[model samples]
Target: MIKRQAREEDETHTAVQGCLRDLGKSLGYDVWIAANDRNRPLDGGKLGDGCLGELPAAVGQAPGADAVRLIDVLWLAKETGRIVAAFEVEHTTSIYSGIVRMLDLALGPEAHALEGMFLVAPDGREGEVKAQLARPAFSRIADLKVHYLPYGELKANREAIARFGEGMKPIQAIARNLV
Candidate 1:
């Protein structure tokens, strides 16, 4: 039972990541999947291979390059290669680690404001997410503005989005602002 549950969680997480990757691509952004997840297939190819061959110069040179590289997904502007948004899917992993990844990018050497930074998780995890965000360790960085995007919301709206959505506005609308 435990193994089955674990497999289910992994599948859910991969599905969400794939949806986000497709959305990012459709919206004219360069998409990147986590380095470790590069082997997972999406859009008829390895997710990482479909992404920017090289990260934007800023992210690559950041002090927390390693952390940034592991971010669940990154959507970069095609023309300038600047990160337009970052997302960390906390399907069943530690939320704290996800937030740390966001912090790595936010406070890194080439620090630049991202239009959106999100924690994508199952809907029931909202309370867990809020409680973790309120922890003392995150107190100083409370202004980071990490939003919460529930799995239910994404799964429910993904098809409509892929068919008719234009840009990041559709996603920003569905994601609840954590602050």
Candidate 2:
């Protein structure tokens, strides 16, 4: 039962990641799924085959290239080649790691390129996300502002947002300001 529950949560994580990828692509951004996650099944193909072959040159050259490449999903402006947003999916794991990754990206030299940072998780996790962000260890994340995007909202609007939404504004409207 424990193992089954874990698998279910992991599947949810992948589904959320796939939703993010679709939204990014729909918004005309160059989506980047984490290198490690590129092979996961999505829409009848591997996510790796759906996203960029490599991290954008700009991000790959950044200070935290290694960490940056591992972000769950990144939406980069097609022309500017800079990250428009970064998302870390925290389905059943501790939220600390995802927040930490966002912090690293927000504070890195390419920080200037990031317009948004998000933590995607179950809707019930919003309160938990708030509590975690309130920690002193993540004080810097507060200043940078990390948004909490509940899976419920993302799943509900993924298709509409992909078909009708324009830019980050649409996504931002659904995600609550966490910090």
Candidate 3:
């Protein structure tokens, strides 16, 4: 049972990876998610991953800041050959508060390399998330883009799934989606 559960978790992670890969292709960017180990926090500071760039320390206290703190995904735009954006996904449970904290991190220097930060949430929640982002501190991060992708939308988008399956090359079908 434990093995089976682990396998299922692996499968789910694969699917999410496939989706991101597809999204990258669709948007024309090279996508990467910061891994905890590879992008380990530096000097016990509130920063991680020298891959994108350096991030400075936080300025002020914010609610639910720590819980929502996680390196989300990073993306580099292929067309312009520049780091386009980095985003952190916040599920239903994490929601508004999580986005706020992510905005705090994204607005820092590391994210400045990108065109903007994306707040990816479950469907029907983009509006609220956007509203929260409208706060003065977050609004300073110019050109921020908010993308909301619901689970249902992902389920219905067969073309996207197919594209992802094809684009994530070298890996077999199962591994492509799983990895």
The reply for model 2, stretches above 4 Å from the true place, is none
In order, candidate lDDTs are: 0.83, 0.86, 0.45
Cα lDDT tens digits for candidate 3, 49-150: 223332222211333324323445555654443445545555544455545545655555345555444544456665666566566655543454444444
Model 2's number of clashes is: 1
* TM match of model 1 to true structure: 0.91
Would you give me the overall lDDT of model 1? 0.83
lDDT of 1 by residue, 1-179 (tens): 99999988887787788889988988888998888887876657776666776687777876898899898998888887777789999998889888888898887754474788899999999998888888899974568778899999998998788788876788888999775
Task: Point out the higher-scoring one by TM-score: 1 or 3.
Answer: 1
Ranking by lDDT: 2, 1, 3
lDDT-wise, the better of 1 and 3 is 1
- Indicate the worst ten consecutive residues by lDDT in candidate 1: 106-115
- Candidate 3 residue 103 C-alpha distance from true site, Å: 4.2
**Candidate 1 residue 29 C-alpha distance from true site, Å:** 0.4
Q: Which 10 consecutive residues of model 2 have the lowest summed lDDT?
A: 41-50
Model 1 RMSD in angstroms = 1.8
